[model samples]
Target: MKRRQTPSNGTMFLLLGFSDLSLAAQTSLFVFFLLSYLFAVIGNGLIMLVVTFSPRLNSPMYFFLTVLSFTEILSISSTAPKALQGFLKAGRTISLIGCATQFSVFIAAVNCESSILTVMAYDRYMAICQPLRYTSVMTVSVCWKLTMIAWIFAFGNAVIGFSVLFNLPFCESILIAHFFCDVLPVMSLACGNTFFLEVFQLIMSVTLIMSTFTLIICSYVRILTSIFLLPSAESRHKAFSTCGSHLVSVIIFFGSAMFVHFHLGNPLSPYNDRMVALSYCVIIPTINPLIYSLKNNEMKEAIWKLTLKIVALHM
Candidate 1:
């Protein structure tokens, strides 16, 4: 609200998303991405079904995982469909209102993932550190509350971010650099002074992401310390195994998010940024179930049996 520029209310914005690619490349990418999206959907869908039915998975950890799968699905869906549409058509275009809405949903979904991962870290911390009190501490009611807070907080953050973006007067050239309506690229189009909003976004991204990652690192550090303190080597190994899947997820998500957010300006190229965004937003969620299947024996056993049951039913 500081500087003066005209607001392009309801003006259409064109996204320069993959339009530079050759016809053959675009067709090839479309086929590949279609398969990947289907796999991610089916995988996450299976997790939701199995967890819902398996009473043994009624524990806090699995409950949190169900919520995560749901979030990952929502997150991937937020941008993938629209991008696919972009590939199919001449160019990706959206009304200002549509851009704002997409921005809000994408931002909220990503934040939800960050919140859920942090909550999962706490679950692991309690399970390993205070095994006796883990149940009492993370009750059914408490899990619901924690999850609600994550969702609510995420949307709220997105709302605030949207407000900042919407308040700014935009440039005449309404072409967005990225595939979808990402905040930074959209913000970069603003004319006049946008220093405040830009700084606000950077600060928010740094603070929230760094703090959550710090908490996770600290949690794992304590868990590892406790594991090593165990009398038996087998017991220590068992403890480490329990957290392996979540730790790997943390590393991938946090590392990707950090690189994308902080490497925004001079250090990053737009081309590399697109690839990174594709990885975390599309590829990571798609492979999330794969990570669980390979790393966590419990989820592997359950998903494998569930897959067999479904196949047999079809037979």
Candidate 2:
């Protein structure tokens, strides 16, 4: 395929505006992102470890949770370290291929997470709405099949998106204004009319966001109706509590993603794009495991036990 070349003016010396910031602000941002990255890794890592070791957590829920943690780690790693390096260095120039690879992996991880969350919502629905049939419906074989499908779909989407994108001709100017090489930022650098790619991305974004979110909403609606019909307050509370963490995580992840990809204006400004990108790419992943672990008793207990074992070993 012939490469689409971007105009010369679009390509310029890209500087991560932070280099112009006061030393204090630079130091503050660096420290903030550094700590955020550390917590993200540790928090997600702990989730994976806990899910792996705890027999009580060997169900479909924790299985999906483990996959989520792994995806979160991959997603954050794609962008945060490079952004941190840019803050420390005088110049942050990512090679063309490197930028494309980063975006591809990041997109794949995000898509995988979306599908996994949808599957988890379905799991919750079965557990609550059809308690007796839950096991049969969400059998071990079914769970693995769903996970595999999610991964394959995500991989295909990422490959197609990146293949289309990398084929575009980039000018000599290689500076990406944002912390990462997101679709829009990279597209803006292309000289040709990226209308088709933009349209395709919008369609994909709407389909993924709306379809998954709709499934989740339907699941929760059924759950809520069932909860209300029950006479016992405790049962209702237990059911709602079980889903609350997942609900919040879904809102943050999908909300931020939809805002950035669907609602953001075309010819978006660098500042606006970067701010929105940070919410999905950096903020959500950092907070998700914390939210899940804190709200989930099983996960909390598993973490506690693991901590104790590690401490005992040290002693």
Predictions in order: lDDT: 0.84, 0.83
Model 2 C-alpha lDDT per residue in residues 161-243, reported as the tens digit of each score: 98888777765545667777888777776775778778887898888889999998998899889889888999889989888
Clashing pairs in 2: 4-169, 6-191, 7-191, 14-175
- The TM-score values for the models, in the order shown, are 0.93, 0.92
Query: lDDT tens string, model 1, 1-315?
Result: 434456556588888777787999778767766777788888888788888887767888889888989988887787877788888566488888888888898899889889999999999999999999998999999999999999999999999999888777776777787788888788888887667777777889989999899988889889888888899988988888878878888889988988887875443566666777888878888988887777777777887787898899999
Flag regions of model 1 displaced more than 4 Å: 1-9
Error of 2 at 111 (Å): 0.5
Q: Indicate which candidate wins on lDDT.
A: 1
> What's the residue-level lDDT of 231 in candidate 1?
96
C-alpha lDDT (0 to 100) for residue 51 of candidate 1: 89
